[model samples]
Target: MMPDRSDLSAIAALLREVAGSIVMPRFGHIGPADLRTKSGPLDPVTVADEAAERALTEGLRALFPDVAVIGEESVAADPALLGAVAGPAPVFVIDPIDGTQNYAAGLPLFGLMIALVEGNQTIAGLIHDPLRDDTMLATRGAGAFLLRGAAARAEFLPLRVAAPAPLAQMIASVSWQYMAADEKSRVLARLDAIGQTPNLRCAAATYRAMASGHMHATVSRRTLPWDHAAGTLIVEEAGGHVRRPDGEAWRPADIDGGLIAAADRDTWHRLRDALYG
Candidate 1:
């Protein structure tokens, strides 16, 4: 069943609860033993990531007992868990902490991301900032909003992407870390055509900045569902455009082929042409 506004609020409260009880307490206290590498030295997972994932998994299951939960750390331990996104049942894709590298270093630039996907479509998405105690959320047909404060006394502000601009006048976050050397070289050579291109090393932050009109676009080489699913929906709901550089819609199960998110379809096309054309 599609979650209504009340259900969304409940989920937001759960996110806040997990952030307060499990995530924030362990933030700056992470030690050498509390951290370990995942895919490589650049990809690290900490105690907070694992603990928060467990708590969120349990909490989400309690809310919807039969729904599937696919978390980043959980999938790392068991690759088969990612198949649930393509299954018939709705699945919650969780990135307990999106910016693990920054979070492990005690930088307050990380976020908690969760997306509810039914088949190939994302129904609801949420990106929560543990340090700020606020959430950016979107339900399929409903518009995106910034949620703050307690559930009983929460505030919701509509979110919109920035107006489209010329390629040389836009600010974007371009992530080419996982790209092929040839493709990376081509992208790097073309970046001079844009106004500013910075990599936040955090998809949640990148998406948040774009949705809040602080950024114009973002190009990513990795398409992990937990990383892009929530942010994709949030950006699209906020009047932005998210798709593959080839101009295809982003599916929950798509793990490669690169993705581009921009303020509008025109901006997306322009950016794609400028960078990949």
Candidate 2:
């Protein structure tokens, strides 16, 4: 069954509490000992990430019985749990801090993400901006919108992607760090037509920019569930488009072959063919 307004509200409240308690308090005050490098030098996880994920996981499990909780930090400790997201149970995907590097660097661009994936589809997803205390939320079939302010007194702002524009006018976010040496040069060589290609280094914020129309598209070579699931649903629900470079629909469990998102289907295809074709 689809989540009703009350259910969605509960999820939003939980996000707010988690941010207020675990995230904001330790944002710029992370001790060096509490931080460690992950896949690369640029990737770092702090105490806040672990605390927030643990808080959310426990709270969510109590709030909704029987759903598997898959957190980025948890998966790091046990690689086998990643397979559970593709299993039969509903999975609550969590990214306590989507941009830990930026957060650790004292930048306020990081955000929180949650998505409920059942089977191969994302049903309800949300991206919460702790710095601004606002959240972008969407459910399949229902529209997407922004909730700004305290949970009880938040304002609802409808979100929509920018209308299709000429390719030369479109802006995009592409992280060069995720690309290989040969493919990186090949892809960068073909981006002359875009207005600008900025790398936010934060998927949560990158997708927010796309869903709210500030950016026309984003190219992601890495597709972790916590990174893409919530953002993908929000963008698509806001009338944007998403697909793999190979033109396959982006399922919840599909992580290979990278992902492309654009203001519309035509723009997505044009950009994909030019860069990946």
Candidate number of the best lDDT: 1
Where does model 2 exceed 4 Å of error? none
lDDT of 1 by residue, 1-277 (tens): 6888888888899999999998888889989999999889998999889989999999999998988888999999999999998878899999999999999898889999999999888999999998889999999989999998886799889999999999889999999999999999999999999999988889999999998999999999889999999999999999999999888898988888899999999999999999999
For each candidate in turn, the TM-score is: 0.98, 0.96
Top candidate (TM-score): 1
Task: Return the clash pairs for model 1, or none.
Answer: none
Which lDDT tens digits does candidate 2 get at residues 1-277?
4777667777888998999999999988877897998877877999999999999999888888877898999998998888876876689999999999899888888999999988868888999998778899999989898987765677778899988877688798877667788879989998887778998889999999989989999998878899999999999999999998888888777765689989899999888877877
Worst 10 residues of 1 by lDDT: 1-10
- Candidate 2 Cα lDDT to native: 0.87
Q: Which residue pairs of candidate 2 clash? A: none
